[model samples]
Target: MLQGKNIHFCISERPIIGEVNIMVAPGELTAIIGPNGAGKSTLFKLLSGDLTCNRGEVSYNGKPLAGFKSNQLAKVRAVMPQHSEVSFPFSSWEIVALGMINDPAAISDRDIQAVMEKLQVWHLRAQAYNMLSGGEKQRVQLARVLVQVWKKQAFPRFILLDEPVSSMDVALQHLVLDFMNELKQRNIGILMVLHDLSLVANYADQVIMMKHGEVMANGHVSEVFTNQNLESLYGYPIHVEKHHEGLGLLVHSLPIHHINQRINKAL
Candidate 1:
C-alpha cells in the first residue's frame, strides 16, 4: 500500500496541503476530487516523490519514501503528471521504452508491445510522439507509464495519475479507465486526480473530497458521494441519482432556480 500520514506542504510559508491522510491499497482504485487550487495536484506530487513534504511521512510497502533512491522508487511506482512534454521527435515505441531504462529486468519487445496494444496505441508505435494530437499523445504517455509498472513484483506497486483523461474523448476516456480497472485487478494500486464526478461515482472504489487543502471527506464512494456531501464540497447544489441499470450512481447539477434558492438560503 501507498500511505501518506499527517502530510503537510507549504509554498513560501503559505500552506497548500494540511494534515492530509490517504492510503491506496493494492487492487483498489482511489479517486481524488476537488475544485481548482484545492491541493489535489500538490498531494499527488507529495505521494509521487516529485516534491518532498514539509512535514510528515509518505511510505510504500511499510518503508519511508525518503529511504528509496530514485531508481529504486521507480521500480515500485509510476507517475503520469497532468502535462508531459517530449522535446525530441521520438517514436512512440522509443518513448515507451524509456520506462524500462532504470529497470534492471530484461524487459522484452513483446512486453512493450502488449502495453501499447492495451492502451490502444500500438498502431501509433512508429509515429512521432511530438506529432500526435493531444489525445493521442496522452494515450502514448499513458502507455509509457503503464509499461513502467506493467510487470508485477513480489511487493505491491502503485500508479499516480493527474487528470489523465482530460484530453481524451468520451469513448477513449472509458477505454483508458477500463485499462486502469484491469491494472487494479492485477493488484496494482491506482490513485488519480479527476474532475469528473460521474466517473468518480461510477468507477472509484474509494473517493477523497478536498477543499482549501484539507480533506473534507474520504471513504467508499457510496458513503462519501451523497448529494449533501457533494453539494458542500463543490459549494453548489448537486443531485445524486441512481443509474437506470442500477450499477452506478449518476450525479448532475441542480436546476438553476434550485441552485439560486440554495445560495440565497445560505446567504
Candidate 2:
C-alpha cells in the first residue's frame, strides 16, 4: 500500500495542500475528484514524490518515499502527470520504451508490442509522438506507464495518473478505464485525478473529494458520492440517483437559477 500521513505543502507561506492523509491499497481503483483549484494535482505530486512536502510523510508500502533510490522507486510506482511533452521527434514506440530505461532487458519486445497493441497505438508505433492527436498521445503515454509496471512483482505496485482521460472522447474514456479494471487483478493500485463525476460514480472502488485544499469526503463511492456531499463539495444543487440501467449511480446538477429560486422560497 502507498500512504501519506498529514501531508502538507506550501508556497510562499501559503498552504497548497495541508494535512492530507490518504491510502492507496493494492487491487483497488482509487480516484481523487474535485472542482478546479482544489489542489488535486498538487496532492498528486506530493504522493508521486515529484514535489516534497513542507511537513508530514509519504511512504510506499512501509518505506519513506525519500528513502527509495530512483531505480527502486520506478519498480514500485509509475506516474502519468496531467501534461507530458515530447519536444524531440521520438517515435511512439521509443516513447513507450523509455519506461523500461532502468532495465530494458527486463521486458521483452513481445511484451512491448502487446502493450502498444492493447492501447490501439501499435499502428502509430513508427509515428512521431508529437504528431499524434491529443487522445492518441494520451493512450501512448498510458502505454508507457503500463510498460514500467508490466511485469508482476512479488509486492504491491502502483500507478498514479492525473486527469487521465480529459482529452479522450467518450468511447476512448471507457476503453482506457476498462483496461484499468484489468490492472487491479494484477495487484496494482491505481490512483488517478478524475474530473468526470460519472466516471467516478461508475468505475471507482474508492473516491476522494476535495475542495479548497481540504478533503470534503473520502470513502467507498457509495458513501462519498451522496447528493449532499456532492452539493457541498461543488457548491451547487446536485442530485445522486440510482442508475436504472444497473447497480451504479447517476449524478446530475440542477441549473443555478432553479436552485436559487428554491433557496429564495425557503428563505
Using all chains and alpha carbons, the TM-scores for the candidates as numbered come to 0.94, 0.95
- Write candidate 2's Cα lDDT for 81-133 as tens digits: 98899988999999999999987877998999998898889999999999999
lDDT of 1 by residue, 225-248 (tens): 998999899888788999899877
- The residue pairs that clash in candidate 1, if any, are none
lDDT of 1: 0.90
Error of 2 at 101 (Å): 0.7
RMSD of 1: 2.4
Off by over 4 Å in 1: 104-106, 254-267
